[model samples]
Target: MELKTRMDGQVAVITGGAQGIGASTGRIMAELGATVVLADVNEDGANATAEAINADGGTAVGVRYDAFDKDAVRGLITDVAGRFGHLDILHNNVGGSWPDRDLQVLDIDDDTWLKIFDWNMHTTHWATTAVLPIMLEQGKGSIVNTITGGAQVGMSIQVAYGSAKGAVSSYTRYVAVQYGRRGIRCNAVNPGLILTPHAVEVMSEDFKRSLFDQITTVRAGVPDDIGYAVAFLASDAAGYINGEAITVAGGGPRSSHDAEALRVGAYGPSVPAPPADLILPDLH
Candidate 1:
């Protein structure tokens, strides 16, 4: 018996595909033989990404997407299905947190909270609803949502953003349970400290260092780390996976290091070193 991960003959639409993780996912899916559509609010960026994919011998197209506009969302999905004849994958990757505005809970205003929800949760709901009909008709489809670690863990800031993403996480399960019988699978990917261009520009050195101190992996995650995960979820390879959120954060925090120290204070005193004569097996 053989296992397959290739997405041959599939048509994939990736929202927010202008750059960062969405663009990377588009490139990866295209490489796996899917005809990828890079849909984004940044039309030029999407076109540039699509052109690059095409130049690399993959099938891809760029289109404008306005996640906040319900009609636009529906129109995008309808247009893609009509043009490609079938839409096999829908990656809802349009989301962001306005760090400046997304302060602690009380500091965040009503408008900011609503905006965060619209960006993170509403967009996902709209896209999923728009694509479900086409997917139901085909009797098979995959939907992957981009969530965030902030939603799963306790965070000091970005309360609204994290809360909105938490809603998305729940929505992922709802879609999977409701449509799994119809051959529709929905899941989410939670990214942690990925060094995308926007992240690099916005994340301060202090913040980066704080995150690095807690991260288990030696280096920060790149867009490809998440792109590959999304590709796998969108492919036949992850057909059995549904309603789950996978963290692509380079293994998250180390159990006994920075995070634990922060949680429980420093070792009572300088902890005594192991006995000098103690022998340890070379597991390596």
Candidate 2:
């Protein structure tokens, strides 16, 4: 039995749909026949993304939404469902690291720590909680959360972001377990070293090199990689893949020591070659 990825009769609400993976995912969902609702704090960017989708012959609408505000989130959900008559998919994709402020727990102040949590975890909670009733009433829905590599693995540098995302990862599973019997499915995507426009602009050469060395692929991940994963999880084909986390990272994690060694060209003395007289076995 083949399940089509095209969502002709479905409507999708993407929270971070202004740019990067959010924009890419919106385009994909729209292209697949979904009526895409792009919600973002960046009104201009969201409108641009939606306009582009419309130009490409896809259905989309852009609106201002701040996921941290519970009341506003409810209104956004209501507006989207009201317009389309049904809400089928939601990509909880709003999150960003606090520059210079994403610090180790000991180094961070209470204000900064709380801010990061509000940015990452609180937004997810607001959106998911607001959407649950609608999904329950609809009797079917899918949610895809955007988490971080720091949370997936362990990194001491971004303690606050990592901790918040860890909470979201757990929340993802909780939603799945609590609602799977009710026809609601939830999953998360952990992106590693994706080269979004903002990353390209802000990442220093040293930082990029460090991450590139950690990933097996010479190139970094792009927004489309994550977009495709989100689309798949939202589709009926992935009905059984609930409460799971798909790491769209290019490869397995490399040891930090190895990455540093390669970065600094500090490999220890090379091992000597075997004697020429030694005959190697060939039992093929």
Candidate 3:
């Protein structure tokens, strides 16, 4: 009973809660007895997600929300707090870059590169700002931001997304320090390559194999892997943990570009060829 009620009476706002990591996070939180708002621009998906949770005897509501709109996000937060009597968590999970548009820094167009910030950092700032006053008034709250693992390490083909998320990570620490004594905590989770449904449908075997080459676990990350991580961080269980970035990736760095011939400075490092047993497969 205690396990199922870990988040009992808490209110959690999960942006992008219609699917993928967002949905999984909501489901787990609901199972723990928290009231979840599955806010997403995809109304149908959000409704479906909420219905599933409600059917399972959990408290949840779906709202058509666009995190990019400052007023809309503010209104959502206000409405949720007024209804729930208080807000306890904000899981900032709304952000993604178009794979087709995301390219090398020099190759990406101005509009495409800038849009990445709108989808990532801008939304995080807007959502966090909206929730601050509410949490402050309540005397406690947690913000779990979803940042990309490539933010600090850098993602070659996804430079724009990585850079924007890097800003989010920095902002997470800033918020943490700013609100620590005020009873609010802010942190970020850096997800490695989580293969959501869209990835499962679109990624080819070769593409997935290449992605797995860098991980020591040699297994693809799934959405549920991220769900549990966010739950713990958003709960009081992590009261002392603030201004940190938790990496949920299976471990290992993306070192393919380090082959020396791929690119200069960009490739990161060069290692002398290893012995037969120490040799790793050539990643494409």
Candidate 4:
């Protein structure tokens, strides 16, 4: 017998569903017969995603809104529930931080920090709060937040982003602990470097090739990797999995011991050093 996905008749609201993992997850959810609403500030990207899903005979809708606006977030939740009659899944894929000047903690201006905070953490809170009532009324729901590997081990440049994502990781557990009895499941997914259209713009081919060198899998993660994980956690198959932080990096970074082994010739394999280890999962 063939196994099937368990999202039939469900409705999912995915923020930043226009590109990358969010787009992939939205498509995956729709393929499983879920009504997906693609919400993003980028109207064009959202419409494109909706078009692809519709073309594939899946149900989808596109909505445009700035995630930082609490009112907009609340309205989105209300609209999705009203239109679909029920809401079952929520994917919080928004949040990004930069190390650029005026955004750093020491020298960064107040507005910049606040903006980053709002973008990375506040948006997630707003979206979650807005949907809580509906989820409570239904007595069952799943929420997945996107986090960063940098937050797990701490990277130098992405201070704000890491801090924001760290909060998400913690909040995932908090949500799960507080609401598990209420039948609401919350989890976080930390994605390694994924090759999205946006990423391709900033990364060179050689740079990407270098990133694959350090991982045990010798491959970088794609959007599908994260999407598939979210799908599993959102379904009844993962009914028992709540408050978990699933790292979606492929064969994450190697430990210093492995590096030393390779250095000391104990490991016969001569591995090519990747140009960038940032893209590798947190195997380290």
Candidate 5:
């Protein structure tokens, strides 16, 4: 059989789909012919996105949801599956780090840690548990959890957030292993410094510049970078890919600190001249 990437006739539910990566993913999946459901706490925003997709000739609906509420999460899944008859994709993307509160491990408070875990880990658990039966009954489904690069690398801040996401990474694998034989596939996508609206609003120029230095690509990552990855993983194109975490951060830093030092001539004349192509464009 020819390789396939189309999502025609499939149904996808994307959490955190009001804006940013979630919204972009909804759009792409809808374009690929899936009936997309954009779920988020931002009810108006979700509806607006759904309206746009419908106007664009794609099937989509927006629903107000609180991922933190187990009952609400279950209801959302149940309603979607009941209406659609099958739920093909579940993108658990509602998660974030509170830079102001998620400080160093010792400095962080218990509430902060709990909140972070709830937002990231608990949400994934609730949604996955709620949807598994439906997917299992159908004998096929794809679940993609959104993870962070910080989970894979050491970070000076957002300790709780990183730890929570680390748990999510492990959970992704467990779900895949336990359900793969039952026609269920679980995977994760690690987004590296994606320039979403919220990211642009909260990230400082200096911070963005510093992050850009660590990225190995010509341009900083946009939501579509991740949206495309989710669409692929959700489609039959990645049928054989399960229980894997794919990093989509424009080829993240290789010895970031050392590379930055070399760029600034920290090693002086002793260091050989770098490749001309190593000089990248200034895009943040």
Candidate 6:
């Protein structure tokens, strides 16, 4: 059966929509008939994305500002509500740090930790807080956030990034539980090593290859994958799936280095595994 995803006359605001997964989501939502507002710090890139949507005969506009700014978020919510009279969806896709800067727990500094928290966790916190009032007024809405496997499994050089993203996942559930009764749904999309423009600029070919090779599917992810998931969660199609953290990874390596023995004994001996206390499991 064919599924129809018509979002005609709806209004959406997407943070970090200038490029990467956020930009792709904006384009997809606009094409599906929503009035997309591309919010980002990069004016040129934001305008370019809006222009592309316009050229495609979709409704879109650019709102340039730092998503981390509380004032900016408040103004954004007010503007979108005043213009469209209601907000149906909000996608929070900002916040990422370089691997070098994103260090392990002991190696990271206070400033770095705070910066990551503000950018990743606080972006979700403030944006969602500011938008909830408008959504409550309308009595229905969806908010999608970006997270990653690292947030749950814990990565070597992503202490700050992982910790902040974990907060996003936790907060997503909190929002859903708090507002589901009020007709709002909140969820998250955790993208793996997607080859976004920002990622390509920072990651070496060898490093990128190693990432893909590590995946069980032997393939890296792309922005469109994340975009598709965002669109689904934003649409009424996902009305029943609130407080979910949907991974966009191609079912990443089921075994970490310490769990390699489990692969060898698939149907044989029961291999010793890491204690459940060590690593967080995927939310069932």
State which candidate has the highest TM-score.
5
Worst 10 residues of 4 by lDDT: 275-284
List RMSD in Å for every model shown: 6.7, 8.5, 6.3, 4.1, 3.8, 6.9
What is the TM-score of candidate 2? 0.88
Instruction: Give per-model TM-scores.
Output: 0.89, 0.88, 0.87, 0.89, 0.91, 0.87
Query: Could you tell me how far off, in angstroms, the CA of residue 192 lies in candidate 2 after the best superposition?
Result: 0.5
Residue-wise lDDT of candidate 2 within 187-253, one digit each (tens)?
Answer: 9998887778877778786676566557655456778889999999999889899999999887746
- Which residue runs does candidate 3 get wrong by more than 4 Å? 1-5, 257-284
Query: What is the full ranking by lDDT, best candidate first?
Result: 5, 1, 3, 2, 6, 4
lDDT of 3 by residue, 1-284 (tens): 34533898999999999999999999999988899999999999999999999999999999998766778977888889899889999999999998888988788899988778888998888889989998998888999999987876766698889999999999999999999899999998889878788877787866765655566563567888899899989987787899998998877455775422322334445323333232222211
lDDT (Cα, tens digit) per residue for candidate 6, span 160-247:
8898999999999999999999999999998876777666677775565455334545346778879999999989888789999888
Q: Please list the residue runs of candidate 4 whose C-alpha ends up more than 4 Å from where it truly belongs after superposition.
A: 1-4, 99-107, 254-268, 272-284
**Candidate 3 lDDT for residue 26:** 95
Name the regions of candidate 2 deviating beyond 4 angstroms: 1-3, 258-284
Residue-level lDDT tens digits of model 1 in 1-284: 44467988999999999999999999999988999999999999999999999999999999997888888988999999999899999999998888899999889999999988998899899889999999999999999999998787758899999999999999999999999999999999999878787776777756666665456455677788899999988888898999998999866744436565643447444323233122111110
lDDT of each: 0.86, 0.83, 0.84, 0.82, 0.88, 0.82
Candidate 5, residue 39: the lDDT equals 97
Against the true structure, candidate 5 reaches a TM-score of: 0.91
lDDT value for candidate 6? 0.82
Tell me model 1's lDDT, rounded to 2 decimals.
0.86
Shift in Å, residue 4, candidate 2: 2.5
